[model samples]
Target: MEKDKKIKLGISIGDLNGIGSEIIIKTFEDNRMLEFCTPVIFASIKTMSFFKKHFKSAINFHGINHTDQIIHGKVNVLNVWKENVSINFGDEDVKIGSYSVKSLEAATKALKEDAIDVLVTAPIHKHNIQSDSFKFPGHTNYLAEKLGGKSLMFMVTPTLKVGLLTDHVPVKDVPNYITSELIHEKIDTVYNSLIKDFRINKPRIAVLGINPHAGDNGVIGEEDDKVLRPTLEQIKSKGKMVYGPYSADSFFGSANYKNFDAIIASYHDQGLIPFKTIAFGHGVNYTAGLNKVRTSPDHGTAFEIAGKGEADYGSFKEAVFMALQIFKNREEYEEYSKNPLKKAPKKS
Candidate 1:
């Protein structure tokens, strides 16, 4: 494929009982998405038929037998499985969970083989999907393991981009996982991703403190002062524009976040709470530092409103848009990095 050409995207239909299929149908309603890339959904034709009948969507569905049959401006589904699963709205089924994982595995295989330029995943049910066969925590860890374990989950919005040092872990065990080496690795990953993947020339990053009031100079806790500060200093000395140990409570409200390109949060909630508050229906949960571009909707499987045709598709749309943008950005960066001073015209 040409570097500047429209990239092919592989879409994985998540939990069938949830709002995954519904949102995927709703998002393709916009014909303009076809102008950017060709989307190939790794799902069953029966599942798409079920959603079309249930939701009364007007999308034109095409059952693709081969990858060459993928067409833009249409929903192209590669039926990987012959699942005769009947879905109940808001109901949990192990069969649906297994199907979701199967679709993910297919999409991941395409990504690894370079068949797809990017991967846009729908929301999956973590609790329902948990099994002995799939012992990973969630999509982040699962993708990490599949992609050789070099991945970090970061929730991105226009206002605030928050990267979690540790994701999907208990709050009590968070402190135990906090180490200078871990912080260094996560921040390094985020910083390099900003420049390489996102195409930011000079990335400025802000790291949040672990404890309340930023440890109040070691009064409440010493982790911020003892661990994070020294790491920040070492990173700063290495010529990366990073500043941190900021109090999580006040940092969200302050305009200082806009000064930096990305925020490295201590844990999951500390980063997501403010990110969702500002960009609830617009946030894109991107798994950065991976070899390939991967993005998902920040929201989860809204099983309560699954088949009612009432689930909001805003986040899912943003996730798709983000994948397209990042794919293009990475391509541009790679081209420019290879040949500096090329002076390409700006894209509209």
Candidate 2:
């Protein structure tokens, strides 16, 4: 990745039967998007051609068979599969889900091999994308295993950022997952991401409680008082600006979230529900604390409006822009760390 080179943006076309194709087509249809990064879609041009025609888009793709063939200033489609496949909009098919997995695998491989600078994945269905090979609940977990990091499901926007302590866990099992060690790990991940990825020098973080009223001093629940409080206290003792155990019920409605750079929710819905409500079509689901940068629209496979051409592409476009910015921020952070400025000599 040369500094002068445009970032090789790798795209994983999500569930073909869903609205993934429509959003991707709409986002890149605007030729102005090519100015930021050279996008390489990890699906066949034949498949994409069908989408383009269906959407009535006037966009053309620079079809390539290999990553090396990718050209700058063009929407490049790398043929991950050659066969023309059937498409049924607004339907759930295991075969179609397998193609989503295929595209993701190819793009992920390219990312790991440094053939692509960053990855911006479209939405994928959680159910049909399950098999012996790909059994993860979502992209965050799968990427954490493949890319090797303490991946955090972070939903982000310019004015608000929210990170989940636990994602895709059953409500009954969330408290069991929240422990002293897990709290420390997620807090460290979010803190470091603020500095290195989002370029926040001194990040202020807040955590939401797992119980109603944050346990109300053990009346409602003891986990928040016994677990969350102690863990946050331990973290604050380390001189980190971490504060929390706030009642999740009133934290966001009271506008307390604006006081911190990031908020760590106790679970998935606690964080994502508010995040989507606030930034719905404009938020980016950034997978923080990973060795490589990855982001996706704050959405999922829109089965109801799959091929109606009514899907919104704003979030998808923002995901691309967010990934590019994070890549540059990480690059700059690395350069600064490698060659830090010499400190001024102490006065006599």
Q: What lDDT would each prediction earn against the true structure? A: 0.85, 0.92
Q: Can you write out model 2's per-residue Cα lDDT over 1-348, one digit (the tens) per residue?
A: 476789999999999999988888888888898888999999999999999999899999989999999999999999999999899998999899999999999999999999999999998888889999889999999999999999999999988999999999999999999999999999999999998898888899999999988989999989998899999999999989999889998898999999999999999999999999999999999999999999999999989999999999999999999999999888778877877793321211
| Per-candidate TM-score against the hidden true structure | 0.95, 0.97
Please state every model's RMSD to the true fold in angstroms: 1.9, 3.3
Candidate 2, number of clashes: 0
User: For residue 296, what is the lDDT in candidate 1?
Assistant: 92
Badly placed stretches (over 4 Å) of model 1 are 1-5, 344-348
Lowest-lDDT window of 10 residues in candidate 1? Answer: 339-348
Residues 117-223 of candidate 1: C-alpha lDDT, one tens digit per residue: 89999988887778889977788898888887568998997657899988999999998998988988899889887777666768899999999988999999989
User: Which one is best on lDDT?
Assistant: 2
Deviation in angstroms for 24 in model 2? Answer: 1.1
